[model samples]
Target: MTPSLSRMIAQAAGRLTFPVKWFTYGRRFRYEQPQKGRGREFFQWDIDILGTDSFAADAEIISIAASFYKKLGLTPQEVKIKINDRKFLQEKLSAMGIDPDLTLPLIKVIDKRSKVTPDNFNTMLTDAGLGTEKVSSLLNILDDKDGYKNSEWLTGILNIIKQYGFDDYVEFDPGIVRGLDYYTRTVFEGWDVKGEFRSIWGGGRYDNLTQDVGASQTIPGVGFAMGDMVMEEVLKKCGKFPALTVNKTRVLVTVFSPELFDKSIELSNILRRENTLTELYPDPRTKLERQLKYAARKGIPYVAIIGPEEMEKGLVTLKNMSNGEQKMLQKEQVVKQLI
Candidate 1:
């Protein structure tokens, strides 16, 4: 299993008050066979808010996750966040006369419903101590899209999520009984609409975890963790990966020769003062052609050459790498062209 930041958060909760919010990003390690989107080590981002049991907290966290996906250029058509409440499911199961002892097992079986065939799922439910009739009733409940109407908690949370303007990206799914047992209410998972990969992210409200971690008092919390690998796969499949430049340096200032290195530095500084990204060649001994090649490979769009001829006239030769056009311009003119 992947390491949890909740335990560490619990340790820190002792000194804090309610409604605490914290986020962490760091490398995570696991010992498991790697696959297309699964790895032994990856970066994960965790965001959690503790000390409130209100449905608003749950809705806020879910909205945060949805907003993150939207910011990454993922649309409701490309991905959706499935949500469910454990307590709501439990109520439905009890109303259906399912044994309290079988609740946990039934939820676990439900979690695997999509992974197994219909026959295998029915068999698994029966093996978990549900009779044929109970299994049939359970399946009907899971398939009911209006089941959330029966739970005031679900209704309130959904309404709050709508207020956050992410209702289109969120939906109720009874089958999303997140695999972790610590989840107490409002469980959620983000999945590609095509169902082409594992969940991009998952979390829910875990009110008792802080107490379990030896806290003197219960600190209700809701959070989610998104791994870099699965997210990358989704972004790739949806053609959402941004076209990022290889480097931030937008201009390369070539040193005409060892004697003109100072001129190159002055030009770089002038461009920088105008908020232009500039890189100066460190080795003046290098040939001008080699410097140009370096800038080309680094994706720098413009290059400034301060050769003896241009220096004599107090001007610069600005070369446009894209069209190979060159212009002789003063320092002020060079800054204007860049900015």
Candidate 2:
């Protein structure tokens, strides 16, 4: 999924209030090769907290994902949220005598460690300018299970997550240096516990993102994006997929005859203006029996029939398709009852 930073840059000019929480879900297109859980075009859900640099912002952004997983019947045993701090890893790299300029490129390499062979991973490090001994040291550091305890910021964020009762779903992973260079701290990914799929979601804090994008003001932000493709796969595998319905038309207005077509259209428009989902029979010449059968097949709950008699009285025959009940009421009264 495309990161939200690109979208937030346009909002920088507005100078929104601090501690802004934004959520959006939409279609995203990518140029990468498609594979399992990966597609060229997909839907993504992005949740972001911006304009605050507090460590609490990091915890809150993470908690949003944890809460969502729990709501979807995904337990801690089925998923884990891996977290790491770039600033913490940067210190380790600097301590190993690596040049400051190479840290970003090195992180890019580390991000791919899971997708490559161990030999290839070492080769990548040396190719990035690390000496043999330095590569050994870096690998040792990455393998350290307790490395996160050394960073106060990392520990603080983890503890905050603990307070939110999601400790089981989160843990520190030293190898999780996200591929993006703009992330200043707190990179995280949601993954299936079985490791059978790509990351379910990923994001981190980008404190300098707005400035990096050429905005006059600096807007600190932390967020994550979840792709629908992988999420749906996970739900089906876990047998938690919910039944969904496609038909949304709540009312169908039938044109009883060619002469009463205008009245049917007018009633349809009126119902729509009242914020109701309405479908008007397109063929004015269609018989009433065919129209009723169409609505029944489409599962429309209600039908409003406008005929010569009903039009003369300024009323509509509202039929409850579910129970085969009909009532004659004024148009206003019908609209109120339908709502």
Candidate 3:
């Protein structure tokens, strides 16, 4: 195997609804050096349901994945992802007289299909203790797994995932060994519809984790992860990443003095009602210009001032930070009038 570590990040969800086995990625390797969206050892957000068995988790995870990609500006049409269960592979292997227990080493070699030669692949399988018959069987299975022309397993898998309501988000593939010994049921990978080399994220069912870790419970779960690195790469390849500016908090509501505190409070309350995020100045003696600069520096959107002229007639002034537009409002109407 290429011996690389991969990470998948998912949102916090309670009680997963899909069966996902543990996926042991290739050798432990991390790039400490920095590059575009990557580091030698960057934190890769991982979301997995180790021990809950259900399809609800799969549905929720896939939906969230779709939502995240959409939020990142990828259309469903541009990205066609695929998912399947490891059980199907095991079943196929069993049919070919390959003991499921031999899955580990064989999987390691299969995962290395990209970086190795065909002759080397054969030698690796022979070293893994597969007889000639077993080798021939494996080769046939691998070759036919990618096509639906004559594989019964492919037919069954396609029908099954469709029933799970993931017909659109998943497909069957024999070549996707996933290289994880514990992946009991489903596995998945996200890819560009055009067959790009990089994928944004992918994962699937694992039902035996809790039991394997010495728990008596057969908690089956399914989930996937998207690393910020690969997702960024995929986005960059697609060429539509929007400029990500640091969104700030804290809107400045000028406090002319304690006299204007009540007015500020009223205006603040009104702003809250309209869902306009803001903050009233805490210091009592800060000057108007100082507060305005503070708001501008902090990137605050709106500022309201209750000066003596407006305060005398029960009025408040609202200022827009970007365009310098000032709006006058009645003191009593200030809170309700400025949205």
Candidate 4:
């Protein structure tokens, strides 16, 4: 992560965002099946805003996440971005008289809260050295209804999110302590409304991560990562995924015979020169029916056939694969129609 982040910073990106494939070994055997959203291999879309510590930066990150959901045609009712701050959590714990040394371990337990049963989660918390009273207090903090209401950092970011018209998609949830220790503040995760799937993505502010990676300068950054597997699943379930279509070769030039192959090639080139995506049938010996079938299979909408007679007439036969409509047109007209 540091290597990629460093490269983005070096490239002068004010905010870096991209999808990356990641691999991890689940050596601890936390769960049996690596199905649904959790797996050893996955693709994550990461968004990071570096070199700023302002609350506006945090708001911008959240807004970007909201924009992504909007682009996917997901409404606020379909998805929610839960946010919390590590600094706030630490302050709460310190006020509760919990040892700072035990905070990280407790956070790990909190991260697994949804994965384990309540009894098992409590046992894990106790095993991590929290007494019964402290456990109760911690649970209260985690479950507080107005946890972020009084938090200046959170409210500031929330106000900015409202300005960006994404407040409906976001909310303050104190339970959102990202599992990673590198995160210093503003942790968040995207969740399905029904809670039927694992988190779509999770990330937060990691102010000191760059310094930990041996960078001489400190780069305060906030970001999130969404795995492709979970996102794809959610989009399909919501019927938001668009119909897949062929993006290349909008027009296919069919070779009628060996003798007129050059005419087909020239037609394809001319169409290509006019900014049209054209594919030429490789073998002139292939039957015209076979070429048309290939174009249909590839979802190429238009096919241009330059046969012996059509070549002699300085015209090409254009077939619309969808409607089976055919017309004889001059080369310029064919190009115009295809483009």
TM-score per candidate? 0.89, 0.81, 0.72, 0.86
User: Whole-model lDDT for model 1 versus the true structure?
Assistant: 0.88
Winner on lDDT between 1 and 3 is 1
| Candidate 2 per-residue lDDT over residues 140-248, each given as its tens digit | 9999979988888989999999999988899889999889888999999998899888788899998887777667677788898888999999988888888888798
**By summed lDDT, which 10 consecutive residues of candidate 1 come out lowest?**
1-10
Q: lDDT by residue for model 3 over 28-138, one digit each (tens)?
A: 237477666565644344455443455556655655565566677787567756655566666767777776678777777876764578999888889888988888888
lDDT of 1 by residue, 229-260 (tens): 99988898899988886698878999989999
Q: Write model 4 residue lDDT over 283-331, tens digit each, in one string.
A: 9999999999999998989999888789788989999999999999999
So what's the TM-score on candidate 2? Answer: 0.81
Which parts of model 2 have CA positions greater than 4 angstroms off?
1-14, 129-133, 258-278, 301-339
Q: Which parts of model 4 have CA positions greater than 4 angstroms off?
A: 2-33, 246-249, 322-325
Measured by TM-score, the strongest candidate is 1
Residue 188 in model 1: shift from native, Å? Answer: 0.7
lDDT of 4: 0.83
Candidate 2: give the clashing pairs. none
